[model samples]
Target: MSFDIGNPSYGLVFWTLIAFLLLLVLLRKFAWKPIIQALNERETSIENALASAEKAKEEMARLSNENEQLLKQARVERDTILKEAKELKDQIVTDAKVQAQTEGAKLIEQAKKEIDDQKKRAMAEVKNQVSSLAIDIARTVLQKEFEDNKKQEALVADLLKDVKLN
Candidate 1:
């Protein structure tokens, strides 16, 4: 090993400097724009994903609130329907009671009318029987008084004519 510090290789040094400069020029021209564009696009995409996540969270919260409100409204509607049904039931019971009372009154009136009709018919029958008894007694007394048949016949005709004229 000899340390010849004084000798310098100028050609080799010049060639090395040229190769380094060419490599720098090639990377700057062909690769720098595309790589930098890729990095920027990645950053933009991450920002878009974060924004979408926040929007989804807000929308879900709003939808949950709406669901709760709808449930409350349904409960109110159900209560209203139940109240109306109870009122209807009460009204129906009252109507039934009134109808029963009216029917009872009608039946009582009909019974009274039947009793009055029966009483009138009974009175008429009694009067007819009394008249029949009187006629029978008169006929028996006339038969006893007249022994002769021809004389009795003449007396009956004359009495009947007199009664008709009066």
Candidate 2:
């Protein structure tokens, strides 16, 4: 047989067309069905992944905002605590100073009272000594005057005449 490129036999052409149609139907039923199903599943998975990524991004943003709020609240609480601590410290210092001043005043008052008491005691002692000395001198003068009783009698009469004249 000779090689023919332009035209072939009718029976050969008909058989070839029948075989191609059979192959196309078989591939569509077996191979193409699974391929199309796999492609659909891949598309669904890609969509799911994209949705998950979007949700994760939204969650991350929400968490970031929550963290910022928490940080701000913590900072406010810290500042409030610091302010309270400073106030407490100032109050303590003021109370301590007041207590110290009160104690000092009490001590000064006690010292003044003690000084007054000592001065009174010293004055009493001085008065007692002076009175004792004056009594002793009066006793000595009386002893000397009584030794001259006859002269003391004449002197007594003159004292009585002087008293009557007054």
Candidate 3:
């Protein structure tokens, strides 16, 4: 721990310099170039990986937008289909109502025609019955009143002339 103001020994300084030079030479020859090259390659690989990641991110974003557009289109198509279906249902309902109305009208017309035919037939039947009854009554009266031929002929001619005048 004594202080000295003198130059150190040549051998010690020379050995120390030789050791430092050897260490520098060994590091330069064996470690520096490969370490720098490996560092550069690692940097390049990292840069390439980052670029690829950025490209993938862009592609994913584009795909996501496309998916959203497709979803919107699907929704629109479904809405259109639903609207068309409703319209078709409405048309079917309207057609059914029209058909029902036409059928009802046809049925009513047929019933009316049948009733008219029945009415005409009933009137004809009544007329036939009345004519037959009247003829029978007339025949019975004629039989009761007409025993003499000459008297019957004279009375029959007078009745016929009276009926013609009325």
Candidate 4:
């Protein structure tokens, strides 16, 4: 433990400088190449990892866009189907209304025809009854008039005069 900072030994200093130079030369020849190669390999691996991350980000963005497009297509198809169903519903309602009106009109026409037929039959029956009553009244009046001979003879003379005048 004799540390003399002021009184240094020249021979020891000279040997220490030589040993340091030798160590520097040996490290440069042996350790520096391996260390530099390892650093370069680490830098290349980092670059490859960064590139893979960027590619994955791009792929995620592309998939998100595809999913958005699919959702939009599905919405459009749903709207189209709903619109078609509405149109079909309207068409069916219109067809049903038209059919009902046509049926009502046909029934009305049939009822009118039936009423006309019944009116004509009633009028014909009334005319036949009136004609038969008139004939019966005329036969009864002629029977009463023809009962007495003298009166019947006088009536015959008058009917002959009336016929001759006609």
In model 4, the clashing pairs are: none
Off by over 4 Å in 4: 6-35, 136-166
Query: Which lDDT values do the candidates have, in the order given?
Result: 0.87, 0.94, 0.94, 0.94
Tens-digit lDDT track for model 1 on 15-77?
A: 989998898889888888788888899899998999998899899999989999999999999
TM-score to native of every candidate shown: 0.56, 0.79, 0.82, 0.70
Per-residue lDDT tens digits of candidate 3, residues 37-85? 9999999999999999999999999999999999999999999999999
Note the residue pairs that clash in candidate 3.
Answer: none
Candidate 3 wrong stretches, greater than 4 Å: 1-10, 148-154, 157-166
Better of 2 and 4 by lDDT: 2
Q: lDDT tens string, model 4, 5-106?
A: 899988878999999999999999999999999999999999999999999999999999999999999999999999999999999999999999999999
Number of the candidate with higher TM-score, 1 or 4: 4
Clashing pairs in 2: none
The global Cα lDDT (0 to 1) of model 2 is 0.94
Root-mean-square deviation of candidate 1: 8.3
Cα error, candidate 1, residue 85 (Å): 2.2
Residue-by-residue lDDT tens digits, candidate 2, 1-166: 7658787888888999999999999999999999999999999999999999999999999999999999999999999999999999999999999999999999999999999999999999999999999999988987888789887898788788888542
